[model samples]
Target chain A: MIGRLNHVAIAVLDMEEALKVYRDTLGGIVSDKVAQPDHGVSTVFVELPNTKIELLEPLGENSPINKFLERNTQGGIHHICYEVDDIIAARDQLVANGARILGDGEPKIGAHGKPVLFLHPKDFLGTLTELEQA
Target chain B: MIGRLNHVAIAVLDMEEALKVYRDTLGGIVSDKVAQPDHGVSTVFVELPNTKIELLEPLGENSPINKFLERNTQGGIHHICYEVDDIIAARDQLVANGARILGDGEPKIGAHGKPVLFLHPKDFLGTLTELEQA
Candidate 1:
């Protein structure tokens, strides 16, 4: 089951501009940008008290975030991540309950350096949901 | 700034079906359904360790959820709520920083019976951002 709201990922056309909004405008402490090549994103974390906001800019044209930006034009909320105590147990439980795990049905190292898997947006209403190992 | 993530709101066509996904499928503990007439939506809260998931179904045709569900068809993430120490201060700061607040630029009594205000999606990279008084 889900433990806590890990972070909400936002796709942005420009990371520097988005950084200005969260850091300069909203006064959120921003983390140093990190390239997540496997995930095809360059990410920066906006630290909040209880959770973090992940700013994602596409690493390449083939990146999933690029596709999202293509549709939204202005970029948008990409996904919401929830932390789970056990990634494998949660995966099996969700799969047993008819929830589909995305990709190869295996966990991948995510932006937080934790095992993460994505659930289909269709199954979770319209929002793409991600589960991360706590 | 933000205190914590209050909840992530998902707009669904049918509350029961959405409930099944979060409650039965994902093994989340859900709250009883409540009709928020003023907000023009019916909501149910799925409690997690650190935050809550708010499931919203349009109460009427004019409801905002109705519009989102119409576009997404299968429903999706509507908005995310972040708790603020002072809603008024947060609003003022955001506005001064060129972020446009939706509605009347005033706070409304939200589902949690706290003052809440929404920021335009355009300014926040297409994510409808909600700020609630913590």
Candidate 2:
């Protein structure tokens, strides 16, 4: 069952500049930062009163974030994360219902060290759906 | 500074079937419902442990939700909302920075009885942004 929202993920071209906007402009405080070499990106988060906002920048050319930034994506909203008690169960249900899982076989550790998985945008229409076990 | 996220809005075709997915299938509890004649949407909400998920179905053909559904859009993610203390200031800042507001002059009372406004997806690439005052 989904519990709550974990965080909203936003892709950015320049992590530093985005940080300034989230921090200085928006008056949000940086809560955490991590570099996931395997995921090929570095991420930073700002804690809000109720939830968190995550900013991601791809590290290299082959990284997904890099390609997303290369396309000159504009800044706005991104993926909406649903907090779930059992990510594996939710993933299974989604798969059983014909949804595509972004992770290989199981839920992977996400930016905030939560078990997270993405549903293929094609299966979810144009929206990117994320299931997070918190 | 903004507060916690109030809700995430999903544009769906059938409010009843969507409610089934969110309630019976997802094991969620419907927390609220509202019909906004001005917005031309009848919304139902399922409250999670952490945040609320809203389903929006347009009331008629002229409603934006109707046109969105008529496109046979797939089921997926939608807008990410930020909770703010001052909707007017946030809306003004967003407008000053070249963002377009869906609300004409002021934030309108949304389905949940909160003041809300939307930013055009074209202004923010393909992503829709919402500002909610709680």
Q: Return the top candidate by TM-score.
A: 1
Q: Please, what are the lDDT tens digits per residue for candidate 2 over residues A78-113?
A: 576778878888888877776678758588887667
Among all windows of 10 consecutive residues in model 1 chain A, the one with the lowest summed lDDT is A60-69
TM-score of chain A of each: 0.96, 0.85
Per residue, candidate 1 scores C-alpha lDDT tens digits across B1-134 of 76687888888999999988988888899999999988899999999887888999999768977778778899878888888889998999998888999989999999899999999999988889999999
Write down the lDDT of every candidate, Cα atoms only.
0.88, 0.71
> Residue B20 of model 1: what lDDT?
87
* Cα-based TM-score, every candidate: 0.96, 0.80
lDDT digits (tens) for residues B1-134 of candidate 2? 55677777777766776766677656678955677778788878878777777788777658866655665475434565778889988877866766688757588886667888887765544456677886
Model 1 stretches astray by more than 4 angstroms: none
* iRMSD, model 1, in Å: 1.2
- In terms of docking quality, model 2 is acceptable
> Candidate 1: which pairs clash?
A126-B75, A126-B76
